[model samples]
Target: MAVALSTLVEEANRYLNCAAISDYCPNGLQVEGRPQVLRIVSGVTASQALLDAAVEVNADLILVHHGYFWKGEDPCITGMKQRRLKTLLKHDISLLAYHLPLDLHPDVGNNVQLAKQLDITVEGPLDPSNAKVVGLVGSLAEPVTARDFSRRVQEALGREPLLIEGSAMIRRVGWCTGGGQGYIDQAVLAGVDLYLSGEASEQTFHSARENDISFIAAGHHATERFGVQALGDYLARRFALEHLFIDCPNPI
Candidate 1:
């Protein structure tokens, strides 16, 4: 059985429950191709490399975290953007992207998935008021030393986490995957002992030191890979389609 593009879009929107919010790009079907989809390819970013891989696999649809037509991007189709769209259009391969929706989804969201991997029982969103809050807060099953927790994250994600330990052990932890250092303040205000994110900025170091909150920066790509993979597996099972998640490693 083949699924229509519109059907897939509707299913994904409902699954993520991010239809109510305003986002930088169109949430579903940014570039339409075939009406019926059988084979679906999932990736973190809809880069040229990923598109090429999709083409090689004769993918009917490409689902990704970062899609084209983002706000503040050059509206004109010129260089790389034009080439990417041209390939999709030429091959009649549909493009679907999630972005913030994928991050905020409770079950398969990046933050929630990371928490689950680290054995953190999620309490709630780091900022309950913001619908787009990508960070999450939770308690560890048992309190462990900051160093031990950091090592656990490293082992789980297959990358050495950058740790900035404070004076306290970590029982309560807050986390957001993929360049979410901006949420450190929210984590601090939420009274979390440790804050974990994918990337670390210069200001983040200062924030951790001054605020007395432990901080860990796991790899951005490493942390985010889980949610999309989980989502792909769910879709594959639900639709009975051939879905494969192609991972392109990123060190940042």
Candidate 2:
């Protein structure tokens, strides 16, 4: 069965509540192709490798958490951006992207999906005052040391995380996936004993040492891999479309 690309985008926007949230990039149908879609390829980013994979699979639509045209990005379609767009246009594949909306979705969100994998019992948003807080504060099933927590993250994400130890034991935890090292301060203020994020900034080590909070810099791609896949699977099931999740591995 085939579905119109516009209908799929509408369903996704509604499912993810895309319109309500503000993001740096446009959240739906960044690049339009065929109106009718039968096969979809989903991934974390619409990089060249992923686009090639989608083309190989004969995908009619490609969905991703990260897509082209960011807020401050170079508007001119030259160099890398040019090549990426050329591939999509050449292949006639529609590109559907969701940024903050994918990360903030409660059930299929990056934070909640990671929490489920790590056995974290969520309590509330890390930034409680903000209605659209992307980061979350939660508790582990039981208190574990910084080392043990890092191990848990490694086991869950299939990649060993860079660790900054804080205490002998940790209970309360806070996390945000994909380049949210800045949110560590908010988590610190939220009183989480341990904080996890997709990537770590240079200041993150000092922040952990000073704040007495543990930190784990799980690879950005590793941490964010689940959300887009989850969203894709849900859509595939709902729409009866054949979907494949392509993982273009990134060590970062």
Candidate 3:
């Protein structure tokens, strides 16, 4: 079954409530392709490898959490940018990307999905005052040692995360995926025993140590893999389109 490209994009935008969320890049259709869509390939990023894989599969559309044309990016399409755009244009495959929308989405959001993967029962937003803080505060079924929690994270993400052990066991936890380590302070303010994010900054260690909060920096790619897959499955089920999740793994 095939849905029109416009219909698919419209439904996706509406479902994700893209207009309500402010993002670094455009949320809906980034690259225009064929009028009708049948197969969709979803991934964390629209890297050259993913594009090539999608083309090999004859995907009609490529869906991603990271897309082109960022706020401060060079407007001129050259070098890597040129090649990426060329792939989409050459194969006539539409590119659809959602950044903050995917992270903030309540049902298919990365934060919520990560919680499910880690068996954390979500409580509330990490920072209630800041809507942009897509990280969440949650709790495990029972308290576990910081080391044990880190082991669980590694097991779930298939990557050993950087662990900054705290003085206490982990119970109330907070997390945000994909470069959200900066939210550690907010997580601390929420009084979580531990906080997890994609990439850890230099200051993250200081914050974790000083505040006595456990910190884990899981790979950004590994942490963000779930949202796009969930969104793709949703669209596929909603529109009866064939969907494939292509993981072009990245160490970072």
Best by TM-score: 3
Full candidate order by TM-score, most accurate first = 3, 2, 1
Candidate 3 collision pairs: none
lDDT per residue for candidate 1 within 1-252, as digits (tens), equals 888778888899889886775788888779999999899999988989899999999999998887888889889998999999999999999998888888888788888888889999999989988856778899988889999999999889898989999999899998889989999999999999999999999999999999999999997888888888888878878888899899877888
- For all candidates in order, the CA lDDT equals 0.89, 0.92, 0.95
The sequence of per-residue lDDT tens digits that candidate 3 reaches over residues 172-235 is 9999999999999999899999999999999999999999999999989999999999999999
In angstroms, how far off is 249's CA in candidate 1?
1.0
Q: Indicate the residue-level lDDT of 90 in model 2.
A: 94
Cα deviation at 194, candidate 1, in Å, is: 0.8
Which is the leading candidate under lDDT? 3
- Candidate 1 vs 2: which has more lDDT: 2
Candidate 2, 1-252: lDDT as tens digits: 999898999999999998799889999999999999999999999999999999998999999999978998789989999999999999899999999998888999888899999999989899989865689989877888999999989999888999999864989999999898998889888989989999999999999999988999998999998999899999899899999999999999
Off by over 4 Å in 2: none
